[model samples]
Target chain A: MSLAHKGLPFDRNRVSFKEIPKLENGYSAKVPIIRDEDKLIADSFAIALYLEDRYPDRPSLFKGEGGRAMARFVEGWSQMIIHPFINVVILMPVHDLLDTPNQAYFRESREKIFGRTLEDVAATRDAKREAFTASLEPIRKTLLSQPFIGGESPLFADYIVFGAFQWVRVLTSYKLFDAGDPVQDWFERCLDLHGGVAREIKAAA
Target chain B: MSLAHKGLPFDRNRVSFKEIPKLENGYSAKVPIIRDEDKLIADSFAIALYLEDRYPDRPSLFKGEGGRAMARFVEGWSQMIIHPFINVVILMPVHDLLDTPNQAYFRESREKIFGRTLEDVAATRDAKREAFTASLEPIRKTLLSQPFIGGESPLFADYIVFGAFQWVRVLTSYKLFDAGDPVQDWFERCLDLHGGVAREIKAAA
Candidate 1:
């Protein structure tokens, strides 16, 4: 979304490993690798921050101390709580919980690492949802009174939280969040700013 | 320590329930609060970033994209992995997970709401550590070449990682990290910069 918002004229390709012919110099099995000029940056945060710094005039992703702190807090919170919860609850269940051949490797990996049965993993999905809701309460309270998490303008914090919320909304039956009037309004404003790739990504998903 | 490095007259006070008698009105019950003039801020990262922003001339706590990204990554990573792990492994074991008097009430409420047990919480901790180590291997490999995670100077990433590592080093016997040569050198550099606040914090612990 940050890339799309940059408004740069570059070739955007959505290629999958199975679709491409195998070759000696074939790309590694990594998604969303951005090749800007000579730099090939991996990792979403790295790419986003790099783009924000490179194109300062596009929009202020990180603004004041309050905004920056909120941004960092939300980014960390989502990565820690929201993303993992969504993965365990929605992705793992739909894709691998029933122990299909394609998911055999993942099942084995989960057992080796976590010492948990498929049922045990599935059972914790509700707890994950609860923890996620608990963590978001403070942020939601703040957002309910203000337009954005940082107040007034949508900053990097909104993007990070929006990404995680969007993932959960698309993937799960959980409807734990009610950002309320101010937050809902701010979210609409954010959509106006960086909704292009976000919508596209969701549509593809 | 950032305050101390700035030659500011700031006093460190350890506050607890028992120490309420010793603390003044405004300073009471705030376990990890910092007072600078009329401003008071809670949370470690918030304080660290605030100090850096307030005292820009002391030394660059966080710098360019590489530095900032590395710092943010470590900060996010610590909150994602270490913070929750600490809650389960150390805090729960010590019977002081939430640091509130309403533990029984909270436990009852949680049980009623989510039906989660201590064992379930512990399992999440183990899972988090496994996932963290798996994700961190790439970061560890990246640190092999550079004297710091970002290179040369000890960026805020070093401090962020150090803060969480301190907790892990003290609380658990999990050998998930080794400083190695480059990381060790960078660690030393960070210690020297802030008059060894990282060292002091660990020592105090």
Candidate 2:
């Protein structure tokens, strides 16, 4: 979305967790590693800063320095608040979509990290769903006052959050927001951005 | 903290929920309403904006337009994320500090809003405490990477979050953080700001 917002087009490269790409900086793993000719950048936040600095004439991922800091705050909020909840909700479904070996790798890694089976994590989703929805209150309230978290149009902050929802959308049919929710309206607005790039993706059943 | 950051000093007025002062805009309630000679501003956020624009020469509460927008994001996060959790933990203790009449008003109003007695809310603190701490992960992670949410010295974003912790501090000695927690270090640093204005306040206990 940040790349799209900046009107930069690039070929998509899909590297599964099972495969590691050898890159400079001695870092071989991470989905968001972007190779701009000889420049290799990893981490979404770092990439955002790189893009903003490298493409100064393009539409900004961050509006300015302050926006940059606040975007980091939102990134933190998404990491701590939104991602964990969504991860639990979609864990089993995501594993189901992986190949047999990939599924085994996913389960083993996740179970070691969580100290619980993926099935057990999915089992708690029904009980935990309300907390997940309630966690979105900050975003819901912000959308009430502004058209976007970026104020008038979608900014990097919007993409920071929308990425999580997009992940959930691709892997699960779960509806995280209720009808008439302000957040639902904003989510629809996000999906509609960049000529419906996100909207065109089909959900996994 | 923001007012101090701007190097502004003025009188302090304490109004209980029971008493409201009438003003020019026919808006009478809410604490933190500041009177700048002839101007009256309600709401901490509005006051911050007003101060920034009105006194641009002073130390900035927000660094720039992007900072302003991000500060609002922090404000939203504080309102929805921190305030609600802190409110639940300190509700009973806060009620305990009120005088007889005010205590009656507090209990009646809160019970009606929460749909439960104050005791019931307090009872859940043991179970809810972990979630409250978990919610601070964003702030904790940010503090790990930056000295302040504003990047260096404290900014309005820092105050937006610190205000909630300040509330918790004055009302209860509940020890919200474990020893050596990053958040605890930040909280201590916040207290030490503005010549320790927040630190000097006496706890209700």
Tell me, by lDDT, which candidate is best.
Answer: 2
RMSD each, Å: 8.7, 2.7
Q: DockQ, per-model, please? A: 0.07, 0.59
- Pairs of colliding residues, candidate 1: none
> Each model's TM-score, in the order given?
0.52, 0.89
List of clashing residue pairs for candidate 2: A66-B66, A66-B67, A67-B66
TM-score of chain A of each: 0.68, 0.94
Q: Tell me the spans in candidate 2 whose CA falls farther than 4 Å from its real position.
A: A21-26, B21-26, B88-93, B203-205
DockQ of predicted model 1: 0.07
Q: What is the C-alpha lDDT profile of model 2 across B68-104, one tens digit per residue?
A: 7667678777888688778887898889878888899
Which tens-of-lDDT digit does each residue in A6-119 have in candidate 1?
666667674433433332244434455677887766656667677777887886566532233334445545665567766666555344324355367556756676577756
